[model samples]
Target: MKRILWITLCLAVMSSCSCRQEPEQVALDFLQSFFASDYKQARVYAAPEIMGILDKSQSIFDSLTPEEHQEVKDYLSAINITVEAPEKIKGDTVRLPYRVEFSRLKEPGESFITLRREGRNWKVYALE
Candidate 1:
């Protein structure tokens, strides 16, 4: 019984520790959540600076007209983003390449997303 309990505890800890998503997945998740207008969920994946920008933008977003808001939503929704594998470009920093497709446009856009390690987790540093 003691050995069984110890094994169960070890398994639980390992499972919990391994549950954190990789930086690339987190970036993709953030983009999807942001485009879906799930700001609360999206913020979880943002760095402090990004969160600050989001917080400051809240008032501006709130003041938009319904039609303007709809237009903005339409534009965001039209974007389909694909996150690529992350490469460590510098110390504790990783760069993730992504492809963005706009439904209203023909050509796709490419960009790199920068992430920094914060403790054991990674956070979005910038979208370059």
Candidate 2:
């Protein structure tokens, strides 16, 4: 009985730890898609609330000069992404925090973003 109880306790702890998604991996996937100029793929990781913001920002997106657009696209592609915060697991969901950096017309720029898990997938939460 004692051995069985100890084994069960150990298994529970290990299972919980192993079930977690690595925040770095999610952050990299998001950054890579964004860098490749694949907004659609990146959108897959965006939370529903983020999609709404993107919708409202469409006009801002359309007003960009071709060079500016390409520059932004290309710069985002080249940078390395890092997760500033590990995901906080909550009843099958996780929230991750990240920071991205890139050079813009010879000037360095940075932004903070959040990602949230939806079902079995992850999505960007918002721009900070």
Candidate 3:
């Protein structure tokens, strides 16, 4: 019984530690997956509101011809995303600014990703 109790306590602490992901990290993961056209992977980091959009995007990609899909994949693979430190906006809300650097472009494009705390985890709320 004592061993069981100790094991349970350890498991609880480990779960809690692994359950929460920082908003900035979530934003970077979402951007990298989404831009890679891996909508399935990206959806895991998205909020409920954004999940539908990712689903739709996935469906569209699935409908594309092989050549078209490869072309888009090759294009996306050449781009890189850099996520900056997250800024806390308000309670449970954070803004992550990121830069998308395309190989052919002289200047990187800037965008903002918003994340709201959902229970123990931070979720991607929106992009601006």
Predicted model with the maximum lDDT = 3
Off by over 4 Å in 3: 87-89
In the predicted model 2, the residue pairs found to clash are: 35-77, 45-123, 45-124, 46-124
How high is the CA lDDT of each candidate model?
A: 0.80, 0.64, 0.88
The RMSD of every model to the true structure, in order and in angstroms, is 2.4, 7.0, 1.8
Q: Which has the higher TM-score value, candidate number 1 or candidate number 3?
A: 3
- lDDT by residue for model 2 (80-103), tens: 566665534555344455555555
Clashing pairs in 3: none
Ranking by TM-score: 3, 1, 2
Task: Residues 1-128, candidate 3: write the lDDT tens digits.
Answer: 99999999999999989988888889999999998999988988889978888988899999999999999999889998988874445788888889999988999999899888888788897988
TM-scores, all models, native as reference: 0.80, 0.54, 0.87
RMSD of 3: 1.8
Indicate the TM-score of model 1: 0.80
Q: Per-residue lDDT of 26-124 in model 1, one digit per residue for the tens?
A: 889877887666678878888987887667666667789999888888778878899987544467778888888987777888888778888877888
